[model samples]
Target chain A: MATMTQSGKPADAIGLAPAAPIELDGITHNYGSRLALDKLSFRVREAEIFGLLGPNGSGKTTLFRILSTLMIPTGGAARIQGFDAGREPNRVRQRIGIVFQSRSVDVKLTAAENLKHQGHLYGLRGAHLQQRIAEVLERVGLLDRADDRVESLSGGQQRRVELAKGLIHAPSVLLLDEPSTGLDPGARRDLWQYLRTLRDQQGVTVLVTTHLMEEAEHCDRVAILSKGKLVALGSPAELKAKIGGDVVTFEAAGPEQAAQLAAEIRNRFGAAGTVLGSTVRVERDRGHRFLTEVVEAFPRRVESVSVARPSLEDVFIDCTGHRFWTEDAQPDPAGGKNKRGEY
Target chain B: MATVAAAAPQAKTASSPGIWTPAYSLWLREIVRFYRQKARVAGVIATPLLFWIVLGSGFAYSFHSSSGSGSYLAYFFPGSVVMIVLFTAIFSMMSLISDRNEGFLLSVLAAPVNRSAIVLGKVLGGATLAAIQGVIFLAFAPLVGDHPGAGAVLLSILAIVLISFELTALGFAIAWPMDSPQAFHAIVNLLLLPLWMLSGALFPADRASGWLAWLMRLNPLSYGVDALRNALFPAEHTLFPLDVNLGITAAFCVLVFAASWAIVNRRTHKPAA
Candidate 1:
C-alpha cells in the first residue's frame, strides 16, 4: 500500500524522483498594466494529477501557458524536466504535451488523420506512427470513430480526439486547460477515467486547470488561486480540514449589519466569521453551541440560518471570503470584493 | 519471464526519443495535406492556366516588334510560366494564416520538433505545390504557344522550382505577424500584382520608363522571368544575358530564403497572441 499523508489519501504509489516534472519559481506575468501572475511558484511531481483551481482571470491559463512555453514569463523562471522553459523551449516542448482550452484538432480532418499529423510533428511515421495513432485513439475510446471527420462528431468526441492528438507522441507530461468544458456529465466521468488510466498505466504526469470544485476534488493535489496569487495548496480533505468547524451560514438584511452581528458573535465565541454578500458564515467546532449565540447576538438581523458539514467549497469560501459559484458567475475585477466593499 | 519484465520499461522509455523526429513527421504531414485537398490542387492548376490563356491572348497581338527570333507566344510563354510560379507561391501564404487561426500552428509549436523544421517544412510544401502547378501549366504551353524543346522544358521546371521556393519564402516572411488571412491576402495582392507587372511578366522591362525600368531591375521577379525566358526560348531577343539572369535569380533566391528562414525562426520564438 502507498503511504498515506495527513490529508487521509495515499501519496503517489510510484514515488516519482525528486526531479520535478514542472517547476515555476517566482514566475510573474503581466498583460499590459494588469498583472496576471504574481510570483507564482509550484511543482508537479511525475505521474501525479495536479489541479489549478481558480476563478476566471485568476491567471490559471497564464500559468499554464508559461509552463507549456507558449508565453514567456516577465520575471523569474519555469522549467520542465530541468529544461529552462524560456531559454531552451524546444527542450521543454519535447518533454511535454499541451491541450489548449480551445479545440486544437483540425475539424476538417478525420480523427485518425489528426492524430497522424500530430504523430508526424513528433517525428513518428511508418509503422510506428500508425501504431501510436491507433494506440492513442484506443486510449481515448475513439478508436472506432477514427475515420470520422471531427466536425461530424459530438463535442465530447471531438475533445477525445484532441486528447488522442496530444498523446500520440507519448509525452512525459501533459497539460490540459479545461478539458471538460463542454463535456456532458457522463462524458466528463469517462474522460476522468481515461486520465486516471493514463496516469496509472503509463505514469504520465498530468496538469489540469478547472474552476469546478468537483473536478478539483479529483486531483491528487489542488492549488487554489485568487487574483493571481496562490491562496491555498493541499489535497481536498486537507483544505477542508483547515476550516475550524462546520459552516453555519445565514442571510442578513445587509452586509453592514451582517458584519456587526458577526463581530458580536465572534466576540462571544472567539471564532472567525465571514460575510459574503448578504450572508454571514461562522465557523465553530460545535455548530449547536454557536447557533444559540449567533441568534442571540442578532435576533432581528439573521433572516435564516443553516449548519452544514464543511466541504471544499466552504473551505474556498473561508479562505477567499467568497462562494465559488457566485464568484464564478460574476467576474470580480477586484478579486471577490464583498458587498461591503471589502476584498 | 524475468528478462521480459526487465526489458518492458526500457522499451517504453526508448519508444520516445527527444529530437528531430517530430519535426520531420510534421513536414511529411504538411506534404500529405497538400496532396489531399482537391480544391487546392484545382486552384493551383487553374490560376496558371488563366494567366497563360487570358493574359497570353490579350497581349499576343500587341507585339511592338518581332525583333526576337520567335513569335509572340514563344516570347511571352516563358514569362507567364514564371508568373505562374510567383502566383502559386504568394497565394499559399493564406494557408499559413489558416493554420495559425485553426490552432494547428500552436499544436505544432507545442510539439518537441525543431522550430526551424516547421518553417522549412511549410516553405518546402508550398514550393512543392507551386512546382506541381508549374508543371501542369508548362504541359499546356504547346497548345497555347510554341512548345519549348525537351531540354528547355526540363530547365524551365528547374527554374520554376527555384523561383517558387524563393517566392514562398518571401510570402512567409511577410505573413508572420499578419492578424488575419484576409489581411495577408490583401497585402499579397497589393504586392504581387505590381511586382509581376514591373518584372515584365506581361511586357518587356526595357520598354518601361526610366524610373519604372529601374524598379523593374530591382524586382526579384524580373530575374525569375528573365531566367525562365532564357531557359525556354534561348534564341529570343535577350534584354539581359542568360547567365546574368540565372545567376542573379539564383542568388536572389538564396538571399530571400535565408531572410525568410531567419524571420520565421524569430517569430516562432515570440508569443503570437
Candidate 2:
C-alpha cells in the first residue's frame, strides 16, 4: 500500500514563504446550452481566504463544483497545489477538504462515528484515526458532544461538525460553498474566526463561494462574477479603494426633477451625474465638497443629498451595471432545471 | 520540531489504507446504519414473516397442484426464503437513492477511494444483510415439513448466499441511475417482482405454457430460485440438476455484479442521468 510520506511537506507548513495554493486557468463550463463559466482565470495565493462572489445565475456554484472535483470543466484547467483537478482528481481530492453548501453529515450517526467514517475514506485508521477525530472535535468545540447523534445537535453545531469532518483529514486547501447559509450571525462570525485561524495558524488555504457581499467582505480577496465572467478580483479594501473617491446620490421629488437636477450638476460642477429613477447619482473625488456645491447650485431642486464610501456592492454595480440584487432581471440561466445549487 | 515537520506532510495529503480499506469502511457503515434504524430491522423481519404466512397459507388449502409430493405451503417454502432475500436486498439498495439525495453520496464521491471499493462495500453490505435474513427464514423450514438434514441445510445455505448476492447486485443495478425511492419501488414492483414471479417460485416452470416456460428458463432469477429448490428438496430434481442450478446461480451472481460494477464505475458523477 502506497501511503503519504514526510518528504512532501511544503516550506509553508512550517511558517515559511507561502506557495500558490490554487490556480484556475481559463476554466470554462457549460450546462447544455448555458455557459456557466466563461474563460474564468484566477490564482489564490497560499494561506489566503479567497471568495467567489456571484448572483444566482453568475456561475459560482458551477466553479465550486469543478474545483471540488464533483464536475469536470468543459474547458481549461484547475490545479490545486500543482496537481490538475480534472485530470488528477484523486490526487487533488487528497489535498483538499470540501464543505458543501448543503448538509453532508449523516444525521443518524454520532459525531465521532461520522468523523470515523470520513477518516476511513481518507485512509486514516485505528488509534491514530480516533486521536485525529478527538483533535478535530476539540478544535470545533464539539468534543463534549462527540457521542451524540448529529440530529440532536443544533443547526450551527451540525455545521461545525461538517467542518470537523473536513478538518479530520487536515488538507492544505478547504473549499466551501455558502458557508454562512444556515448559520446565525454569531455562528457566522465564529465560522469566519475559525477560517482566519486556520489560515494564520495552519497556513491552510481557504476558498469559498458566496452570494452575499457582506460575507465576501470577510475573505482576504474576492472574485466578483457576473453572467459567467470575472468582473472584479482583488481584496475587499483594494476593490473598494479601486472604485476611487466617493458616491453621491441626491433624492429629488420625481424622475423629472432628478433628471433636471442631474443635468444642472453635470454642466455646473462638470461632475458626471446620472438620473437613477428619483435619485441623481454622481461619482466625484471630493464628494463632500461636491455635495454642498451641488446642493447650493440646485437649491430647492435637490430635496436631500448623501455621500458615502464605495462598498463591494458598489464595485459589483459599477462593473455589472446593476445592483448586487435585482428584482426584475431574474436571469436563472440553468432554467431551474438542476435543483442542486442555483443561488 | 523535526518530528513535527516530518508529520506535517502527512496532513497535507491522505494515505491509501490498502486496497480493501475503503470497502471495509463503507461496508461497516452500512451495517452500523442498518442496526441503528429499528424500523428497518422490524421491517426486515416482519415483511418476510407476513409474506410467508399470508401468501404461503392462502395457497396452502386452495392450491392443489395436479402432481406434487407435499402441500402448497411446503412447495412455497424455498420461494418464501428467496422473497426474504429479495425484500432485504431491496431495502438495502433503496438507501443508495436516499444517500444520493441527502448529500452523503457527494461526500463519498469526493473521497480519495476508488470507485470499485464503493461498489464492493455497498453490494457486499446489502448481500450480507439479505443473506442473514434468508438464513433466518430457513429456520422455519421444519414447520413446512421440508426439513432436510445437515448436508441439505449446508447446501441450502450456499444457495441462499448465492441468491442473496445475485439479487442484491440486481438491486444495485436497478437503483444506480434512479434518483427517487418512489421510482425505484415502481420499477422493482413492475420488473423485479415479476422476474421472481416467473422464476418458478409461485408456479412450477414445468407446468407453464409454451413461451412462459421459456421465459422462466431464461430468467436468471429462476436459476437462483431453482437452485434453492434443489438444495431444499434434494430428492426432487425437477427444475434442473443441483450442480447445474448452483453453477447457473453462481454465474448469475457474477453477471449482475458485473452489470452493477460497470454502472457504478462509469466516469461521470451525474446521479439523475
Candidate 3:
C-alpha cells in the first residue's frame, strides 16, 4: 500500500518512496550582473547531517537562502519536505527550522520567552507550548538557565539557547548557517554532539553551511562549492579517498623553480603535478615513494618534501585547481579579502 | 540521482492554527519589548511634551495670527498630539530596520505564519503604541483651554487611531525594504516631516496662498489634521464638515494599509539563512 499526503500524491501516484528531505535540482541564482549560484545540484538524505562547504564568494549562503525559501533562485528548482521551495515556501517553511549566521535571539528576552514566541509562530500555545519549550531546553542542556535573559548568558550558552529556540516547533529538518562559527573548541564539540544525538534519537535531518575544513569533518556528507559551482561532493573520507591516495608537495625557492619541479615530476614520474605558488603539488597512489624519488632526482633543487593523506582542502584543490581559502590563514572575524594571495 | 529516494517529509496535517495566534503573539512582543525599554517610554512622552511647550510658546510670541485669540499653544495643541502620534508610530516602524540588521526579523520570516499576519502584528503593535501616546498628549488639552465635550471627545479618540494606523502603515511601507536605520531616518525626515508640516498641522491650509494651500490639499495627512482639529476645537472654523474630514481620512487609512500589505506579501528582498 502507498502512503497518501494532504496535498495529494507524489507518494501514492507511484511507489517512489518518500521525497528527499531536501533536493536542489540545478539551482541557480544571480545578483544583477554577477552570478551567485551556478546550476548547483545536490540532495540531502533523511537523518543526515549535511554540510554545504565553501569559502567567501563560493555561494554556500546563496544555496542556504534557496533551501530555506528566503530567496527564490533565478533558475532551476529546489524542494524541501516534498514541496517546491519557490512555489510552496509556506509548506516548506513549516517543516524546517532555520538558525541564521547572525544572532536571532533577542537579548532582552529570557530563553523561555524566546522559545515561547517561536512556538506561537508555529501555532503552539498554552500547556502544549510550555512542555515543548521545556523539552527542547532540556535537549540543549539549557533548562536550568531558562529564566535568565539571553544577554546574561555566555556566548556559547546563548548559542545553545538559539538552538533551543529553533527546535521549539519540533521541525523535522534543521537548517543552520555556519553553526559553529563563533564557538570555542569545547562548545563546537558539544554542539555537534547534540546534533548527532538529535539525528540518532529523533531521526531529524540537519543541513549546515561552513567554510572550515575541520568543521566539514563533522558532517555526514559535504557538497563543496567554489565560485558558485559545485566543485565536489561526498563524505569527508570519500572525498579524500577520491584523491586516490596521498598528496605530495615539494617546496622550491621560487615560482619559476616550482613550475620547473612540477614539469620534472610530470616527465620523470608521469605525475601531472600542479605548481601552486612556490610548491609543486601531486596526487599519486603512493606519495611517499614519489616524494623520495622526486627529492633524489632534483637533489638540492627541492628544499623540502612532505606526503600525507588528503584533507577536504586537498579535495577542493584537486577539483578547482586552486588552494582552498581558509580563515585559519586570516584571523579577521569579518569575511575579509576575497582576492588575497594564496600560497 | 534516480536511485536516491530522498526521505520525503511526513505528510502535513491540514489543521494548521489560524493566523491570529502568531499575529497576536508578535503583537504582544512589540508591547512587551516597548514597556521593558525605560528610555523609549521616557522619550516618546517627553519629546512631544517638550515640542508642545517650546514650539507652541516660541511660535506664539513670534508668529501671531488671527484664527481666534489663537493662543498659538491652543493652535499647536492639536498639532502636538499629532506629533506625539507621529513620533511614536514612526519610532515603532524604525525598529523594523534594526530588527533586520540585528537578525531578529530573520527568525520571524522563517516561521510558518502568513505574511499578512506579520504585517498585521507589527502594524497593530505600532498603532496601539502611537494611539496611546496620542491619547496621553490629549490630557494636556485642558492646559490649552480646549477641553472637548463628550461627543467630540469620542470622535477625537477615533481620529487618533485612524491617523496612527495610517502613519504607521506609511512608515512600514517606507521602512520594509530599507536595511539601515540611518537610511530609513533620512528618507522619513525628508519625506514625512514635510508631509506633516504642510498637512495644516503647522499652518491653516485654507488661508495659505500660492502653492502651499494646493500642496496641503494634496496631502492625505492634511485631512487627518483637519479631522483632528475639528474634533478638538468644534467651535473653531473648519475647512470641511466633520463627516467629510472623517471620510477622506478613513479612506487614506485604507489606501496606506493596502499598499503596506502588498509590500510585505511580496517575497522579501532579504536573503535566506
Query: CA lDDT, every prediction?
Result: 0.74, 0.83, 0.82
Q: DockQ, per-model, please?
A: 0.33, 0.48, 0.43
- Candidate 2 vs candidate 3, TM-score winner: 3
The Cα error of candidate 1 at residue B209, in Å, is 0.5
Q: Rank the candidate models, highest lDDT first.
A: 2, 3, 1
Cα TM-score of candidate 3: 0.93
Tens digits of lDDT, candidate 2, A97-124? 9898777888989999999999999999
lDDT by residue (A1-343, candidate 1, tens digit) is 1233565322321232234777878888776577878998888787999999988877786787788887778888887766678876766776687887766787767899888778776667789888988888888878899898888999888888888888877888899988888899999999889889889998989999998989999999999988788888988889987886788987788988888877877787787788887778887788876787778877898898899888878877877888776665434333233111111
| Top model number, DockQ | 2
Per residue, candidate 3 scores C-alpha lDDT tens digits across B1-273 of: 433333334554434546898889878888988998999999999998998898888888887657765788887777788888889888999988777767788788878778888888898899999998898788888898876888888899999999999999899999887767788889878999998899888788877997989998999888888889889988777678778888998998899889988988876433532
Q: Model 1, stretches more than 4 Å misplaced?
A: A1-17, A322-343, B1-24, B59-66, B69-76, B267-273
Distance from true position, residue A200, model 3, in Å? 0.7
Q: Stretches of candidate 2 above 4 Å error?
A: A1-19, A253-264, A273-277, A299-303, A327-343, B1-13, B66-68, B269-273
> Between which residue pairs do clashes occur in model 3?
A19-B6, A19-B8, A20-B6
| TM-score pick, better of 1 and 2 | 2
